[model samples]
Target: MALSLSARLPSCSSSVFEKAHKLTTQPPILPFPSNLAACGCTLLPASMGVARRRRQVVGAVEEQHNQTSVLAPKQSPSYSSSKLVLVIGASGGVGQLVVASLLSRNIKTRLLLRDPSKAISLFGLQDENTLEVREGDTRNQNDLDPTIFDGVTHIICCTGTTAFPSKRWDGDNTPERVDWEGIRNLVLALPPTLERLVLVSSIGVTKYNVLPWSIMNLFGVLKFKKMGEDFVRSSVVPFTIIRAGRLTDGPYTSYDLNTLLKATAGKRRAVILSQGDKLVGEVSRLVVAEACIQALDLECTKRKIYEINSVEI
Candidate 1:
């Protein structure tokens, strides 16, 4: 049966980098990065970064021994069932957080990347069954084999290149190709049974030719992204298009934080989700990633499109 993508969507159950999406058969997970469970707590590599924090945690635990047994009181988290998520652009800012949050939630994840080593470097070693890595650029169809989506129930595509001419555009990985052609190719190859495809797009997609948006759309990044969104809408699969504002902060470092992922955005401000594509502002990569995760599990957001930005308190 053909499913029409929703034009307007109600807010999904959400929070400040916290919120859980239910519904799925338990599969696997991609541990959130933070040692404290905010994603990136295990960052900076162990060289000069560990001893200080380790001391803090250990000291705190010891000092609080008369009361809360910090380590002992913490029990292993029981996880709910999850659908398999195929994440593209896994090394990108939002992509990493999504992968990390999925892992933290014990949800199975597969990453399609141009460089698989980046996954290991950014996310560290993970159980192959729970976190699988494949190498393929969205711009290359030959690399996107049918086997890649074999068990993928949900897909989050955050792949994108620079907006203008730069080193990042080398090898024809330009907006026209990466944002438009790449997305078109991916939608064309998606399996029929796919539950949802959440695409990370930009804010000015609708007004690319207008004033401020036109400035950013010099090289047609917004235009191409809109093209991608349109293609997905036209496709048979269910879909959600998350149009994000100018991104502010960076992607959180990922880690094996095996538990229900919450506050994945850390100390970021409140996230504001909007409809009608009227929102214009900056948002953290964390909020974008969190919203994407929420949309995947929200029935109201299915086949819907949304624009999101963050506010500082």
Candidate 2:
């Protein structure tokens, strides 16, 4: 869980930026202010200036769309009162951060991983009051402890393996196992009361082809991921599917958040950029965690699939 917080800064390089440029998709709708910083990303609204600016920009976009983007009301039903969230695959970069961010907000978190002890050293999480780690895996439904989901309101699946392995070897089979069937198994294992599920998925999975690229390429990835996405979409449960841009262990930087959602409202993509893999600016895993948490509480985020990448801040 602490590993999630460890990624917080920026560095700059043209090659990295070029890779970033090629990797980035169309931007989010509202252009984020240039002055915004990615540091302290999870708790931005604590600053009235940032909160005010966010409201103004979101309001502008909504007005332009002739549609409303409503957050759960101030008197919204206290789903947070459920107190616990079960984050599957919580040993990974995104899942670990999801756990940390939830715990940082004083929310109870039950992290499920294949090996809890392994994650202990990897995540550097020693905070007993804020976190709990359990041994489990998506492939083995029987391994999950039902008590973990007793009063849980939301679930996040960060189950897929990082794609670098596939890139390194044409014979790799991790993606098919982890991203495809593994997702189906996770879905089958969910509790009926679980209200929200957010999946961290990659962009271009729907585009890349398998010929020159390996069978594990994004296109190949998309072929399997799309199956999983479709399964989630068609399930009785509500869900949010996130197609993320290039991932980096980079520093936190300002990024415009949503694009497909913007385009659906008749707007073009807004160009956004975070510091690429360096300390100047980047997308913090912590921010992504918070965004997923907030998504569970917002009507605007329900039953929707959105994309996130660096945007002009």
Candidate 3:
């Protein structure tokens, strides 16, 4: 029952990951910087057990990357040989970053997309073992065949649409369909042994009927998203729900996987994590992407719902 609230964040940066690595390797004593201290922010320390688990997770990725780098210096390194991650909505803003990060870590990834050709255009060609693409629509239960979940130990679902009507809703992909029904269908079809399901949700769901949130929920997006979250919670599958703020940063729709891998957070390098859904602001798609990847292996994140946001240092 871990719940959290966070503010908006900028894009992703390698420094962020580097700092995270350092946190795991060193003693878990994180002190707020002078600027953050002036803002009256506080930092929390992870228990030794959590630190060890974090270290193992980060160490494994680095070790795998080192080994693969030596063998294939010219190609992207494949690090995690045991985990197969299935990413839904891999073509979207956050989803693209998630896939790029996963591939960069050398983790095996499978994508469920309506147009398989998009995978080719965005990610370019790849070894089937490293990046596999499957054509399917979550709105259709039949589209979520059992085979689609084969070998998929983890799932990061970033499927979403605009709060208001737009071209994305062309195929009856409304909030009711995409957010609620789509999520319900996917959850029902998931394999019983799936390790985790990280769902990207919106922040105002709990108070969708209240003022500003009500305005955004004009078309029921927040309401449907809450429904989706509830369904996932009721299931027995291990899950982590990341409630994001108004998303900022690029959708990076036109960028290729290489460009995506190099994406940065610019000035937004600081992240804030908290409990309760009390914060509200925009968040970088990159930050959300990184959060999903990190949550996959962090034991503390299991069966928890966290709201993530970022601020300038």
Error of 1 at 12 (Å): 6.2
TM-score of each: 0.73, 0.60, 0.76
Q: Given candidate 2, what's the lDDT at residue 84?
A: 71
Instruction: Judging by TM-score, tell me the better candidate of 1 and 2.
Output: 1
Residues 19-95, candidate 2, lDDT per residue (tens digit)? 32344442231122332221211112111243354554453344234422111012222223446777886755556
Worst 10 residues of 3 by lDDT: 1-10
Show model 2 residue runs off by greater than 4 Å: 1-81, 122-129, 164-173, 210-219, 250-286, 311-313
Q: Give the TM-score of candidate 2.
A: 0.60
Question: Comparing candidate 1 with candidate 3, which one achieves the higher lDDT?
Answer: 3
User: If ranked by TM-score, best first, what sequence of candidates would result?
Assistant: 3, 1, 2
Please say which candidate is ahead in lDDT: 2 or 3: 3
Cα deviation of 154 in candidate 1 (Å)?
0.6
Model 1 residue 164 CA deviation in Å: 2.2
User: Order the candidates by lDDT, highest first — what do you get?
Assistant: 3, 1, 2
> Which whole-number lDDT from 0 to 100 does residue 239 have in model 2?
86
Global CA lDDT of candidate 2, please?
0.50
Residue 211 of candidate 3: its Cα lDDT?
A: 90
| Candidate-wise lDDT, in order | 0.65, 0.50, 0.70
The residue-level lDDT of candidate 3 at 223 comes to 98
